[model samples]
Each structure stands twice: as C-alpha cells, then as structure tokens.
Target: MPLTFRKSFQILPGVRLNINKRSWSITTGGKNGPRHTHSSTGRRTTSMDLPGPFGWRKTRKGGGH
Candidate 1:
C-alpha cells in the first residue's frame, strides 16, 4: 500500500478538518495542497485547537449514511 500523508486540522476532540487549498502556496505543499491561513503569518505549522460543532463522524447530506 502506498503511504499518503494528509494535512489535517483538529477543531476539537475527535473532530478534524482536512486542508483543501485551491491555489499553490508554501503551506499547501506548494500547488498540490490547500493554502492555510496560519501559513501566511510565517508560521511553520498551524494550531488546531478549537471546538467542533459536531462530534467525530462523517456528515451526510439529506438522510443518514
């Protein structure tokens, strides 16, 4: 199996938000990743300390999946 590193952020316990950049930025692995708001501030990494609205679970549209 190929190993893939996914840049993700955690808003709160059991909740994480994946980075999805539309443009090329240094924070976004340059072109392939999504640009981060924390990266523009000359920060090597961004902090993912926040509260999540929903628990750790995949959100489904319309009805439950």
Candidate 2:
C-alpha cells in the first residue's frame, strides 16, 4: 500500500516544511511542492521529535516521528 502520512507546514510566503516516513524536507515554491534546498537523509533518534523546528532535525526511519 501507499504511504499517506505526509504532513506539510508553511514556514513563509512560498516556503514549506514537509514531513513523511522517509524524510523531512523544506520546499520552496508556489502551489506545488518544493523545487530547491532539499537536504540529504540522516538517522533520527527519539530525541529528534522534542518540538522546535523540524527542519533542523535529522531524518527518521519508519512512519515519521
């Protein structure tokens, strides 16, 4: 089955924060998803979800944090 656990947050006028099972990314553009400034994946631990800016955190495994 397909994973539909994606969540998005607007950080600015045309910038967004995207969180999914695979990665957490910052997308910048209009209407559609981000087309720039995508970061590489990293291993995430339990402490990564302590609330703050998720953009500064590492990517987690499984179905998001």
Candidate 1 lDDT at 40 equals 29
lDDT of each: 0.36, 0.56
Clashes of each: 2, 0
Give per-residue lDDT, candidate 2, residue 35. 42
Worst 10 residues of 1 by lDDT: 23-32
- In model 1, state the lDDT of residue 48: 30
Instruction: Let me know the TM-score candidate 2 reaches against the reference structure.
Output: 0.46
Error of 2 at 58 (Å): 23
Q: How high is each candidate's TM-score?
A: 0.23, 0.46
